[model samples]
Target chain A: MKTRIPVAVAFLSGFLMIVAFFGSGEWLSMLTNEALRYMTIVAGFSLLLGVVSITQVSWGVVRKRGEDWPYKIILLIALAAMTGFGVLQGITGGTVFEWLFDKIQKPMMATMFSVLAFYIASAAYRAFRARTVEASILLVTAIIVMIGRVPMGQYIYEDLPSVANWIMMFPNVAVQRGIIIGAALGAASMSLRIILGIERTYMGRG
Target chain B: MANQGNKGFFTRLQNVDRRVLFVLIFASVIVPLFFPLKLPVPVTPETREFFEAVEAIPDSSIVMLPFDFWPSTLAETEPMAVVGLRHLFRKNCYVVGLSNVGMGGPSIADRLLDSIGGEFGKTYGIDYVNLGYKANYQAVMLGMGERIEDIFPTDHRGTPLSEIPLMRRVPNYDSVSFIFVVSDNVAVDYWVGLVNSRFGVPMGAGVTAVMAPKSLSFVQANQLVGLMGGMKGCAEYENLLGYPARATRGMDSQSIIHLLIVLFIVMGNVGYFAAKRKAKVEG
Candidate 1:
């Protein structure tokens, strides 16, 4: 019954949206709009479920005193504090929520992202070797693109930027289009399968 | 003895301490910041097209700016957002800010809008409105085509859309003249596929460097009117505006780092080939 009901709902919704896309009736448009609204609302409520699931998992680890239990405790405390502040004072500027986000959260996130530059440097030094013809080609291309992206490349060679642009525009776009078309075809097939009740994996185990 | 020492040096180069690389990168980034190389930044075709797209918008036309990026990518994306908003306001466009990212996107947009809008003496609600973050971006985007208020009933601050003067005139995608999405994620895809393709609204995007290659296809296909790839792209836009800001200042550091990385790669390759030849001779 669960599988059947979900499949039926999915089919109806998908069919209606497709019909509305090609049709021009006001009622059809209204139906599509309502469906979209309901989908958004349902997606919003999923966040509540996520919070519940995480709290349960973290609390279980804390109660059992498992590995990294201390981290779990910290996570729970942070979650509670942020939620409480958000619910009470809101996340507007100058509030406790905003303060935490600005002072602690923002810098931490930026620092974490900034660390990628070091890692990229280290990775390139260790792994970017030329063992074969193809590897040599890739290595040369990478070096060119890296230099060509910066102003120093122009100082070194004026035509470097044009070559880099040509590579990005022609070869890059051609490959990307191929991948996009392939992926779109796959997505269409999957959507068809779900609509036709052939894909019941989303319903979970029986 | 000298030959053996040479072999050791080459072998060590193949596995140089990562900390050394890290420190070199750190110095490269920091030194440029203080010294200010002020390298000449040439605008790319894509960035020029992006600028033209904004310039083509009629004065005081309503435009949607979606901040679908997080704070982690603020270094690259924020400059794009700042330059984009400044240009739009300079042209007297009414800005409607929104986000597909529920986590930090709305807050970031709110902060940027407040700071930049204040600079231009633009009034909130009257000249601009932040519709804020909505869940299920795909659905929110599609629903917005029918009625924006249906997707976002209130601004990020919980004020009803009906109360906002700008929102009164901008009801749906039909009313919006253009959409400029600054995202660090694949939300740009949904913006192109669902919003632009269906609603026929012109769109542009600013994405992180990692995502730029994929986004270039959209620009080539004319799905996106323009695109800004990364910090470099942002710097180019700043240059075009004749208002060199944070991005332009950071380009020197970016250039230094790129050069350092290339040097490291070349050194590593040289070491590998040397080691290979040495082993062959010994064997």
Candidate 2:
């Protein structure tokens, strides 16, 4: 009975959305918009659920003095402080929430992302070997692109940038289109399966 | 003795410590920043198309700018957002800003709009309005197709859209002349697939360099009127605008890093081939 009810709800909603896509009527459009609104509301509630889940998990760790419990405590404190400030003073500029975000979070995130450059450079040097004809072709292409996309590339050769553009425009687009088409078809089929109740994994274990 | 020394050198090159490479990369990035190269940045066709698209928009036309990136990608995406807003305002276009990204996307857009809007002496609510972040971007996007106010009843600061003069004129996707999506993720796909394809609104995108290759197909299909791919793309846009900012300044560092990586790759390959030849000789 539990499974049947949820499955029925899914099928009804999915079918309505499909019909709304094809049909042309004010009532149908209104119904679809209302459904989308409800979906967004439900998604918003999920954020609250996430907060609750994290708090519970972190509290449990702190209570038990688990490994890295201190970090968990810090996380909880940070979370609570930010949430409190956001609720009390709002998240706009000149607020504590915005101040913390700008001063602490933004630079940390940027720094973490910047670290990837070093790893990418090291990986390229170690892994990019011309052991075979395919590898050689890839290596040559990489060199051309590396030279062509920047100002230095133009200095090295005026036409290097043009060659890089051709590679990106032609070979890259051809492969990307093929991938996009295949992925779209797969997604459509999967959606149909879910709507038809053939995909029950989302319903959780029996 | 010469052959022995050659073998040692090749082996060392093949097994250079990763820490050494890290230091080199760090130095490459930092040194260029301290000593600016002011290299000549060539504008790409994609960036030119993007610039021309905004330029072609009639004066006072309404445009939607979606900030769909997080702080992690601010380096690549922020310049795009800044220059895009600058260009839009330069044309005297009414701007409606929003975000599909949940984490800090709204805040980023709000800050950019405030700073850039201040530059143009533009008034809030009259010249621009931030619709802010919403959850379930798929639903938020499709709902906006019918009525934006339906999805976002209020501005980012919780003021009702009814009070915003800009919002009063913009009702739905039909009212938006163009959408310039600044993203570092797959949200661009949703904008292209769900919004542009469905509503027929012409769109352009500024995506991270890593995502550029994948986004090229959309540009090819005319799904995106123009595209800005990473720092280089941003630099190109800045150059076209005759405003060389962070992106232009950072290009020198980027160029040095790229050359350094290429040099390392070449050295590694030379070492590999040398080792192979030595093995053959010994055998």
lDDT of 1 by residue, A1-206 (tens): 86778989999988887887778778888989999999998998999899999999999999999999999999999999899998999987788998888888888999999998888789878988998899999988887888888777899999998888877889878989999999999999998888788887888853
Stretches of model 1 off by over 4 angstroms after superposition: B1-7
Model 2 chain B: lowest-lDDT 10 consecutive positions:
B1-10
* Candidate 1 backbone collisions, by pair: none
Could you tally the backbone clashes for each prediction?
0, 0
In model 2, what lDDT does residue B7 have?
Answer: 54
**I-RMSD for candidate 2:** 1.0
Which TM-score value belongs to model 2?
0.97
Interface DockQ of candidate 1? 0.83
Where is model 1 chain B poorest over a 10-residue stretch in terms of lDDT?
B1-10
**Per-residue lDDT tens digits of candidate 2, residues A101-202?**
999988999999988888888899899999999999999998999889999999999899999999999988998999999999999998898889888788
Candidate 2 at residue B128, lDDT?
89
